[model samples]
Target: MARTSTKRLIAQARRALAEGNRSYALMLLREAHDGAPKDGAAAVLLARVLLVQDHPMAAIEMLAAHLARNPRSAEAARKLSDILASVTPVTFSRVDAAGLAAALRLDRVTADPLARAAGLLLAERGEAPAFTRGTDESALLIALLEAAPVREPGLELWLTARRRTALESLAGPAAEQDEALLAAMARQTWLNEGVWPVAEAERKAVDRLDPADPAHCRAAALYLPAERWCPGRDGGSDGMPKALAGLAGDIRRERHEMARADADLGPDISAADGTGDAVAAQYEANPYPRWGWVQPPLAGAVRAFLDRIAGGSGGPQPDGGWAGGPLRILIAGCGTGRQAVEAALAYAPNARLLAFDFSRASLRYAAMKARRHRLDAIRFRQADILDLPDFEPPFDRPVDLIECIGVLHHMADPFAGWRILLDRLRPGGLMYVGLYSASARRGLTALRERIAGERLAGAGIDPADTGAIREIRARLLARPEDDFERALAESADFYTLSEVRDLLFHAHERPLTLEAIGAFLEGEGLDFLHMDVRPHIAEPFAASVEGGHGESAVLDLKAWAAFERDNPDTFDGMYLFWVRKPG
Candidate 1:
């Protein structure tokens, strides 16, 4: 049980794992963890072994127990949250109410992952389960109601329907406190951007209620915008009850941060060129994604992490005399800072990251989050992709990695912006690029064309118009199941205003074919390293193309193009791939 003995056991476990003796490694890790229950390394390794052994339920249980005992263990929380987020519905079938209750107790686990677990739990149980006020499930429900910006449709439907029921039976003086159920409903309605469809009866009920009442204020939150509901009746709700202070504080912080960003955007955010200005305007109005929580990444060196994701085929191995020193990463368009924050956490002290975005508003949001997380590894700047070269002096060392996901396609000339970003990469450095696939976006393109051709209300509405987007969403929902437009309702982006605008109403978007992208890479003398794809897509494509050349088959763009041609929706979101500059 001594520390030295536990370290030796962990060393043995690593050796066993390197030799592909997973069972032996698991046994050794269990011994290490049993001796040093508080050791994060042993706990994380043991849980991972359990996951690999196809006992995710066991893994979740072990991680939850570890976190419960050692609440300061961030590694255990990260692993537990990742499992909860990635666990399939079938996997959830094994998780009983007790298992979920244990998971709900994990501190530092974000609301998104917890909501996912709770939602999947409900999905397994079929009909909505009764939630007792003091139970873990009820706590999860309240937390989701308070902070989940991402939609879990099943949970949302259940909560909204329950709210409708609560409103239908409105009784007592409006000045009285709403029951816990109505309070939770009000929080959810606000978090979802106040766009949840409301019935006329409910609106009338809110109209009839007294503004001075807590119940009335809670009920009004369901149908009215935050500004209206909290209208600063007495110099910014000085008399606001403690129960509602959190919601008011959130609204106040967002407005203040935005106003502050406008004045302090810094000198780097010079006037953008051409369509860049328009794209900037769009994001400045509403940053593409307004994320609530971030899942901390697994601890590892960036190089080793990339190698694992690259599969058996080699990752971007250092070449051209480049040393494997601390990483210098440049995030070309870090909207809202979600990706950049994850990178900052993942790379930690070993990486220097610079994340830039077109919108000062997004930079402000991203910076606020980074500061909140206490991550000084990253620096957020407001800069255009086109203006990057002018800002970076030629004598400065180039970055080892450049991440440009879902950003280039919005430019007036994507390739021009891409070339500029490419030049900033050190020789032998890797670049991660995500672009819309022309073949896969046919349905969405068709939808856009229809909207423009028919001059739908969404076509002419301002990009900042949430009401119009809500109307469009309602119309899409009303369509029959077989309707092609109705299929868009399945996207999570449909639930949020900024996401909806970015998804459908972008000022400019250009999707490219894989063939064109491959040709461009070849022309630029770059090597296609790997395509970041799900195993479901990669496995079949590898099996069909080049007779399953292990992971190397993923590097063949021709095969990917052929696979995409057959499966038009394979890359519906985007073709996210890694490429290395030739030495």
Candidate 2:
């Protein structure tokens, strides 16, 4: 079990692999991994060998066991995560959740099993009640809630029923006193913007309670912090029970801090009347996609990432300041600062980034996140995309890269905004753009039309009304599982107030087809270097092309368009691709 022996075994395994002796490599790697169970490198090597030998299940089990021992092993975790993500409908047992949490993006994990379990429990018990302590469902739900927003509609409905039961119990002496359950509810409601509908009777019961009462504040925590039931109770938490008051205080502190951050956001490029103002107002009210956690980036040079993605497709090479000094990056509409922080950290000590958006609330959220990450180099400013054409940066020179993802399609003129962003990019520099595909989002488009036509016919629903949004959500959720509109329930956005608004009730949205995108690229005279498609789409499309996975096939716009026509949902997320400006 000596460290030297493990290293020697690993070195021998590598030599065997290089010599075309896979069996020897596998045997040596297994011995090395068994000797040093916590050694991530040895476990990763063993797993790779297992995979190459057509033993995928063995590879997964080995990685899982390695993660259980050394949960912080990035090498083992990455390999496990890649395998898990490549396959669909991954079922995690109750025992597996805690061990896999370190490797998997738990928020994105399928909640269908949890929903089915809860449903079976409800059917047996006659109703959904307060989660009893020490139950499997309770522990699993709490872990998922804490990790990320739970996106499953069935789980949301089950929780809503349970929340109502807990609220009703608050009116009696033997109230819902489970602190862990209360905390989990608070986190879920806060993340979802209190999208759960409250029955009028339950609302009236909560209305009759005193705001100063400890139980009232506890019940109110299950709703959004801004709701009427919890108003003016800040600092009033003093002299109350510690567990009850702490949750309330935490919510108030977050809102207060966000307000302070809003005041501190530098620069102002606020636009008056038109599509820009309406869109700005929508985001200002509820910052889209309230993010909690950010994944740390692996540090590397900016050009290294470009080369990996570009694969030397042969375009004009970037020149000027980027070649020798800090790579300048402009992240237009960097909502909540997740993208900005990732970019800034990924190219640390070698990149200067400016991230801006029109909504002060969003910019404020992003700035606070950047500060939390200790990223001082990012210039977080408030600016509308329309105003960026006239805006000047503190640093001179066009940026080496411009990233405008999921932003331009909402504008009155997406092309004009794209043109403005392109002008800011240095010649031969790269641009990454993500635009909505009209073909891919046909179902969502129909749903949006239905909501506008049926729900908001004459009076028009206010985007900020939680009650109205909840009603609409309930109606959608009531649909059959096979219903096309019911598919919205599967989206993470459906669980959150702000995201649902952005997705289904946006003031302005225009989805484009690939044909239009190809034409725009032609007119703009930019080289289409790469389309960031996942392997499932990329592999099939590349095989269909004449050159078959060559540089020409990857860059073939017409082929890509035809592929999209055949497989419409290829870009359901967006048409995220990279292009280079002519030198």
Candidate 3:
């Protein structure tokens, strides 16, 4: 076949595969392979189609034949190895072992044969007995060891004894030559022990062994006593003691905070202002607050914003027929309860509001705020957002109003969590949620992440320790000139506006958009009453119009959008929407 014909056949096969015509694709690929038996690309494609069609043994056979003709072909070698590694035992046991032996004989089997053997062993253990020999013997042995049932006393004891002897031998004189092997042995032993403290101690001891000696570094890092040995820094291991102490302190502080009552609010309003003596006293009394972000002004602003959102100015108005009864609002992820307290005071004057957060220290502070205001309508609970069993049953009626701002974006699965919240809403209930928007700030975040990675690598900062965090924070807060550069470089799991739209509206089947409030009311049998663009900033401007302008112009646009989107009740910073279900 001509080169042009082969290319055309390959293109057609790819198009068929993309269009979900797998059988047609396989036919085209087979023709292409038949025309050019020596063509590595055609062989690889045929192998891929065979695998997709649930014929792993066939795929392996095709790849092996291609590699036999072109021994130096890296692509063919790679494809063949991958197919072998992934083949099921049912398929692998049926494979011509003699052919595989020939391939191994051609060159040293440096690639991971253990993974391949494991897959094969999973389907047929009878063929595994023959695998424990030759230069590639260890791979087969390890695979059989892993595949052997743990509950089988005979096999378990045999593998355990074999593993122990192998590890002990590695600990001998020649262990230095294969540090990775020695480390792997140590990790396996530690995992078998099932004791964290013992494992940690062993890891520490290993780190103290010797860096010039790779075996020690690997063993220490992988198992108990895994601390880096610094010969001159101190008689002790390098930075491990300090790191351990910091972790212990964090755990202890959290426990202490959880045990304390929420009566920290003093009669003196000055002390409650979160400044000067108050801040010092609070820190001394409760240490958990020291670990996280804290800005008194920002907290106050968040509270004020929540109040505006709940005041019925930008939210749905209660029907006169329903009477202004006690409204039940729930605030999920109510960190510090600042916004929760603000909502209670601003909107639910005669209603009951429940606010919950994961951090005991934050809940305590929020409880203090509620007490300070003498507000009886608000209640605070410390609870995980994902596991909200406590709030589910007693509050069986869907929440009348729920506010979750700057919370969903942090969750590992934002869309899933958002769906859970939506399920908890009353038929005519209102909800407000916020997420980090991808824009100028996202660019800054990526830059910061890169800088952090570089600093961690350069300083040899332990990834598990607070040292990296401290180093990054110091560089970020260094000078005005350094701040912008550092901020821009950092990366985080933030979403762009388009990503948010697809996630909430498209993927999860939730009704979300810039026009979510109105659309949900109309489509979901609710009332689309009002929307607020931002709640945190004094000035409001669309994200597209916010940057790259004079301060005067920025402020002017912000002022205009404040009224333009939803007048008199608009606040800038976070986008807010409110809708109500009709009774």
Q: Mind giving the per-residue lDDT tens digits that candidate 2 earns over 1-583?
A: 8899999999999999999999999999988988888898899889889878977667776776676667677777666655544433233332233344444323322333333332333333332322555644455456555545666665666777777877888756785366776677776677677777777797787667664666666677676454444444454544344554544565666666666777656665666449988888889887887765444444455556576654354444444233334677899989888789877877667678888888888888888777767788898778777776444564346777888899989888899889978888777778889999999999889877877777454577776676778778888888899987777776657777888788888878899987888898999998888888887887788777432758777788777888888888989899999898877
lDDT of 1 by residue, 175-248 (tens): 43335556656666666666565555666776786545665566666667777677643455643555666667
Of 2 and 3, the candidate ahead on lDDT is: 2
TM-scores vs. true structure, each candidate? 0.83, 0.85, 0.36
- RMSD for each of the candidates: 4.5, 4.6, 24.1
- In model 1, where is the ten-residue run with the lowest total lDDT? 314-323
Q: Rate the local accuracy (lDDT) of all candidates.
A: 0.71, 0.71, 0.47
Residues 1-583, candidate 3, lDDT per residue (tens digit)? 8877888899999999999999999999899988887787888888889888988778876665565566555555556655554453444544444334334333323243423433243334443453344433334333222221121222333443443443344357663223323333343332222111122333344435554343443334333322232232234334333323332243344434533545432211222122223322332232221111111222234334434444444334444312344567888867666677667755644557888765455576567546555677776765545655445433566776788876665455555566667677765566766644433234434553465357455574432333343334334434474455433222111111111112111111112223333333355554433344432333444333533354453333333343334432232134454555554
> What TM-score does model 2 achieve against the real structure?
0.85
Ranking by TM-score: 2, 1, 3
